[model samples]
Target: MPTPDTRRALFARGTWPEASRIAAVLRLETVGGALLLVATALALVWANLPGGTYEEVRELHLGPAALGLDLSLEHWAADGLLAIFFFIAGLELKREFVAGDLRDPRAAALPIAAAVGGMAVPALIYVAVVSASPSAPAGAATGWAIPTATDIAFALGVLAVVGSHLPSALRTFLLTLAVVDDLLAITVIAVFYTSDLAPVPLLLALVPLALFTLAVQRRVRTWWVLLPLALLTWGLVHASGIHATVAGVLLGLVVPVVRSQAAGGPDAGPGLAEHFEHRWRPLSAGFAVPVFALLSAGVVIGGAAGLADALSDPVALGVIAGLVVGKPVGILATTFVLAKLTRAELDPSLRWVDVAGVAVLAGMGFTVSLLIGSLAFGQGTPAAEHVTLGVLLGSTAAALLAGVLLLHRNKVYRAIEAEELVDEDEDGIPDVYQR
Candidate 1:
């Protein structure tokens, strides 16, 4: 063991620096998101203004292009810009599954459990609450799932509000849980939520994604090679009528996680996860999410659904209850069950109380939830508007409440040890590529 001074030096570069990095990242995200919230408020005000143009605010496609590529660039923000935001979601998902907290099963268990409970319970509640035709008659059953997601950005932003005292462990927990939440949301889109099935573009995407996977297996690391291939996949997948954002997830899977174990291998260094994150992370967080928030978060009220309608509507209520009530209970309950039965160790640095608090915060499902809304509600009805409002309201509440609760704790680096996850090499098996 090192002496206190030696440990202090370690803390100097790794612990303190890590904490600072987390703080800075969280601050930027929160501030940007708050600005997004403000812009959304302005949009609402503008739409409801006496001579203002809510109809004029409708989405417009870019008929003119700089090159041959078609882009959506009218008034609505969701049409063109949100793709990069989801692309970042894909990248982060890839990283966690690689050499991050999600690398080991024990490390991932709590978040997975919480995520599942958060998803399932909220969905059930949403269905129960919205089993009517007030907003959508035939689509009522499936609409409950609308509010069952957690927004990773908003959750991260909320955690930022608590400042640096927010434990890295908590951050890890939230990130991993959000990945599982996205996975569930994706499944819902592919399965229960789709309108019509189209196979041509999906097949085209599948072919390239398969080839890309083969490239990884052979240890191909050409950024030029992988980059165009991903764009091709994105184009085909979009044309195929599946959610285009999923193309990013499929492409992300083909990207390698950690440095190859062998130095002689083609992918011998910091792997695609780190490479992409280092280069593209800024663009995603800085530009994509902000743009998405600016476009998608705006809602006008004049009983085309008022705030009261969102609060009182069955679809909205189900979403509100599902995210707020279902998420924490599922996380805490399942975590307790699994840990006790298997005798897996809890993080020694944190108390069960801390775990409880973190679970509460995991309900902030803004970004992913919004994306899911676009998928589920975008083409359909008035409840889509109501659902969007409910998502904002629920995510905001979860974030603020969880941040305050998490602040009550002092220690965060819970010393968790697991048995089944042993490896001869120190780095542990990468979870980044699993999905």
Candidate 2:
């Protein structure tokens, strides 16, 4: 290991603990992504059936109306179940910024810049396409945020499937980039999307949020103490009309990432955030997101004509263009500019082509894309349906394109691996490590 005076290289493998944690998170996300796909497929089939049964089920209302809790099943899926997804996102974000590779400003710079560019270019491209298209919906501009998100689970799942030989650094880069992207998406939702916001409920939401924060900070792990406060906070935020998912992020932000002194000091061991992430990630990934997908992805395609019409719609076209073209362009351009400005270089073992492949993979926007689409165009509107199709098509195109590129690169890495193995057989150490 290098002396304390020597700085570790950017995108180095990181600590063993960090690597292990990343691997675990990727495994969870990979499985979650598979479930998300299955749910989407099921929803599509249910939606296209002759009876309109899926729509009726989605429209069915439940819960207590006294607290504005009674809502269509679709609304609950969007507003409530997704809070769990966002909560996990929040936990991951805080952990990264606080104790992960992102705590180093030098390491954080590239991914932060790339995430901003990824979001900006997509939004701009969407606006441009919508503005230029005559057949765009009246409020299509609102959906500019649709392609700004990178679904961590879907992208990670695709990578896990295709990139066995890929370098660990590339995976780290993608994870950091996507986490930052999620932060931006959450900001857009809270600031640009909120309407009819109620100050009383919004202010009142702080009470439970604070209590929950305190509980986590004190290392209170009991489910009974924490779960009710979390639910109440979510409910009040929903009442305030600031998307309930925002509450999840807020709650996540407040959870302490470092261990308290009584627990053996800051670096003694994993803190509550990690513990909470471990507990809730399964619920979010396995049940919450797939259920949301079941409820939201059920857009009835009226055969070939309907498919043609959706693809023709300017809104849909914009979303597809944004994901397939704008995302990679933005990420690559930003990374290039940042490297030039800082006079920094990628890790010695990696190449610009490797970065290129990950940039393209960043285009796979799914979960938050669909969420923003629904919020932009009212749920169940024709525009919303078009948005769903665009997201589906755009994400699929990105996945296919990225897969081809990464698979080619994977073969190159595999050859490198073979060479290293040969060297190891001769000297009991890989040539690169021997260097």
Go through the candidates in order and give each one's C-alpha lDDT. Answer: 0.66, 0.88
Residue-wise C-alpha lDDT for candidate 1, range 1-435, written one tens digit per residue: 889898878865666686557544634767656656665576556656786464344454554354323544422244335555556666677788777777788878777777887777777777776764375345656565666677776666666666365446767777788877877777777676556657876786787788777876666767687767777776676666666666766666666777777787655777765666555655666666666665666666676447676677676677777778777877788778888887565655446777777777877766667667666666325766777777777877777778777665532321112223223446664332110
lDDT of 2 at 356: 89
User: Can you tell me which runs of candidate 1 are displaced by over 4 Å?
Assistant: 1-39, 50-58, 63-80, 132-138, 210-225, 260-268, 303-305, 410-435
Worst 10 residues of 2 by lDDT: 5-14
Instruction: State which candidate has the highest TM-score.
Output: 2
Name the regions of candidate 2 deviating beyond 4 angstroms. 1-27, 260-269, 421-435
- What digit string (tens of lDDT, one per residue) describes model 2 on residues 1-435? 776434334223445566556546634757888999999999999999998899999999999999899999999999999998899889889999999868988888888898999999999999999999887768889999999999998998889888899888888889999999999999999999999999999999999999998888777878899999999999999999899999999888888898665556644566889878876787788788999999999897899999998989999999999999999999999989999999566655567888888888999998999999999998999999999999999999999999999999999888877866435556565444411
Candidate 2 local lDDT, residue 86: 91
Per-candidate clash tally: 14, 0
Instruction: Name the candidate that leads on lDDT.
Output: 2
